[model samples]
Target: MSTAVKHDDFQLPVMSGYAKESYDLCKAHKLSFQRCAKCKTFRQPPRPLCNKCHSFETEWAPVKGTGKLYAWTIPMNPIGKAWVSYMPYVAAIVELDEGPRMATWVTDVPHDQLKLNMPVKVWYDDLTSEVTVAKFKPA
Candidate 1:
């Protein structure tokens, strides 16, 4: 089962193996994704094999960390007490320059200023000593 850690009342993903590697790289402020070494396909939410070529040959590849805001939504209601503090947060889907879409929170921009296809870049937030969540903001 996937593990989660509680931080400021929020349950965050636990770092292990691929996830660990991703977070470790994020701690160093690097953005990356798993790339199929055989077919040169970049994938997120890292897996052991390529979905397209069905090959186990893969490697963590760094990305340019630039993307366009594909979509977004503001939660009108909090899911739980843990989310109360972030009630007005914006959840967004960013279509990366490499063509992968990442689900992340867009910050540093007002909700009224958000626009479709706006240029954005990845930013890391160290939620804990061992975990850093990727966020996005206007570029």
Candidate 2:
């Protein structure tokens, strides 16, 4: 009955509630956001209530996965041993075309060349059968 998941000393999140719903969409290779059915506002980090109108109704709306690089930082150090090999990686915030911003790894692009508002697109990485994470790259 343990929900803990480990991969090379890195522990994955136990998917549940809204998080599990979000990751489930990623598992299907569809980048989605919870759109407030009342206000039509899309939000990242899915929640049961809408931030705009405080509506409890929402829907999983898929996006084009194309966006602009909102912000980023090159982490010079690893937070965990599992990320030691990935030091100096780009941690970025991507503003999706529909308007929500999501934190993701920006791959295949040098950190020196990254600029605010640069176009990026979503890509999927299957960390496990039930967990598919989204990353981004230069569009």
Candidate 3:
């Protein structure tokens, strides 16, 4: 298998193996999906057990980044010291087209502009050579 060569602009992912697929999807600019074996349901936030049937069989699937805003919140303050720089960022609950909900960062736009029921798509931020975090924002 080939690996991404590092250069002046090369970025790494945050994890490997399990989350590797999500990182790869981000690098490929697609949203990775997780599927439940028992329910045949697609999901995010990769799981080791099927939420629907409590089965241990689960699979990662790819998904289109488009979704509707299921819920949201404007944090009163950033918790960690590093996050202080981007205080008041919107933490959102998105209902994906596949019928699963995802908690991802909303970015690429000002926080004030976010509203319930807004359209959004997947966005990626490369955090390391083996990790890339997924976020969402107005589409």
By TM-score, the best candidate is 2
The sequence of per-residue lDDT tens digits that candidate 3 reaches over residues 1-139 is: 1112223243343456657766677666676677887788665667677767878787766677788888878776755554554556677888777777877677766766777888888777555554556678789
**Per-candidate TM vs. native?**
0.87, 0.89, 0.70
Residue-wise lDDT of candidate 1 within 1-139, one digit each (tens)?
1112235557766767888887888778887788899998876778888989999998878889999999999886977787766667788899889887888888888788899999998888777877777788889
Stretches of candidate 1 above 4 Å error? 1-7
Model 2 gets an lDDT of: 0.82
What tens-digit string does per-residue lDDT give for candidate 2 at 1-139? 1111234467666799888889999989998998998888886777778888999999999999999999888877768887766667788899999999998888887667889999999888787877988888889
lDDT of each: 0.80, 0.82, 0.67
* Worst window of 10 by summed lDDT in candidate 2: 1-10
C-alpha root-mean-square deviation, each candidate = 4.9, 5.3, 6.7
Clashing pairs in 1: none
Tell me which residue pairs clash in candidate 3: 12-128, 12-129, 13-128, 13-129, 13-130, 13-131, 13-132, 14-131, 14-132, 33-61
